[model samples]
Target: MALQLIPLPPALWTSLPGRSSVRTVADVIGSTQPWRPISLTPDLTLNTLLSLLPPAAILVGIASIAREDRMRLLSVILVGGGVSVVIGLVQITSRDLYFFRITNPGYPVGVFANRNHQAALVACMLPMLGVFAGLRQGARAGAKLQAAFAAVAAIALLPFVLANGSRAGLGLAIAGLAAGLILYAGHQGAWSSLTRSRAWRLSAGAAALAGVVLVGAAALYSRNDAITRISSATTAEDQRFQFIPQMTHMTADFFPVGSGFGSFDSVFRSYEPSEALLRTYFNHAHNDALELAIEAGAFGFIVLTVLLGWWATRAAHYWRDMSRDSSARRFGRLGSVVIGILFVASLVDYPLRTPLLGCIFFVAACWMHLEPTGRTQKTD
Candidate 1:
């Protein structure tokens, strides 16, 4: 049956200047007036909003100490993730529904509006979730569970990442894995007494050699016709290089107070024209270093650098103190692995922009920095 539309009240219609011409409520909402005053809400300011998030997340993570609390936190994240996946599916199924072409052709976007962002969100969440699941069980049990989840997430995510065809995401994921492994080994004290033992030295040497050989083999394998086509299709080197000059130009023009947080894309396009082969609109500078430098300038960069340095120092301190406690060691290991992945991921992608992933990483870093003395204090 066809539904009948309800008519608006005469008083409501009379209140609007052009109500007679408006066909629907959307038309009323769409109209803009020059005389309207701007609202200065706390949420409207980027810095203010960013400030509120970390503390809140830390509090929540701190509160999640009991098994039930931990489960609850995990449930929330998973539900959010599931919702994101459904949104991604809808965006793909109803291509014509969204105005932005980028949101469609649904890559594993999860709940994110952007596929790359979605991939980054998943990458950050999955590792931590896997680690938590692992740590909840015995060492062997945890390792098995983590490995299974990691494998499944990786497999499920790989095709979606491929569908998005983001070279940056692929590169970041590989880098993240490498970083995770290094941190994992460090937390395990796998290299602590290296100089004292010939076995350790030999093992480290062999691992390094194997890594080099594996990389070389992969490079050679990727040069095949099928691989070459795929590689060429996904490659972003040319586009990335093109933006370096543009970034430099934009940075110089807006040296001190950046064009503003959400103003980079507009400013960049105005600064440089798109190359014929690369006519895509770029919202970010592709490099986090460059993007931050451009958006926040030197001051913001210094603050970020100092924060990272402090976090790293804390991580090191806690790591060193993990010698006595087995639980602390496990926590340090998992936390370091997660942080390493995020640090590496940030070098190429803008996962830091997403609140969920960013909050998790920030809190995890803080958690890892806590020095565990003899007794295990209950941390919620």
Candidate 2:
């Protein structure tokens, strides 16, 4: 699927930014790392290349997107996300369920090695489904069809998010849905009359449906790990909390230029805290922001800030001018929502390292800023 193609370009970019310069020559020559001639971080040459591919592909593929391809793109995301949800649902039922059995013997994981990663993948897809479902196109039949599909998706898919046992995903999913609701309301001019009967009815109905689904999911799948986790509050402090200062130290150690891009896994071990839960290997900074600081430092932060600023500014323009095309505004909302979710989740977990979720994240970002093809619709 073309869904697989969008993430490659960014991968290449990430790979090249921090490479095997004079600083890393010792690691390359003395260590067992296989040489990747073009890689910026030779230690993780293969991993960086693999990690960056999907995003790079996504960036390259999105150049042609406009109105003609908008719906098609949404369809692909919705369909792929829907399938992932199904896989998750099935995986939850059976622990040796998905392909990654070795990683979690008694626990269920999807195509991803971590259940949290699987949940993140699903969470990334939810906003698009909401966008497609809520998009108010001129065609009534098409619009209704989309609504129906969305309703079915929500009913079948939302429960499994809980089933997957990812509290972060659950929080992000709620935030993402709220963002979609704002886009929907903006398109419908619902904000102009908050007490309007139509608005009241829709809100009440959505609330009722959500309550029922959550209750039903709990009632039916009481044995679900997510439910049990919620009931027990079983999570322990991870090594991430302990390593925060040390990672900050790493960023300072590297300064403006990072230890290298894709070098977090290899470089973080030395500075790892004495109290660390797992000293063997720390593949990521865990906190993406800190990781960026460690790897890219002030420059990386600056670059990240600029890119986020650009996305936020573009989204604001779309959301502010109510007269802008509805689809365009929806794109902006989707991007904002995904960014928000990832930013929040990244605080605790390394979802971006997983190729599947990361690629979906890039796709959503493209949709958020995709150029509108039609004339703006005037608000009444």
User: Tell me, what's the RMSD of every candidate?
Assistant: 11.4, 7.3
Error of 2 at 16 (Å): 19
Per-residue lDDT over 183-258 for candidate 2, one digit per residue giving the tens place of the 0 to 100 score? 5555565554454566556656654554455656767865456656556763344566767777877777667556
Number of the top lDDT candidate = 2
Q: How many backbone clashes does candidate 1 have?
A: 6
Q: What digit string (tens of lDDT, one per residue) describes model 1 on residues 208-244? A: 6434533444464432232243457533555656667
Q: Please give the TM-score that candidate 1 achieves against the real structure.
A: 0.61
RMSD of 1: 11.4
lDDT of 1 at 32: 38
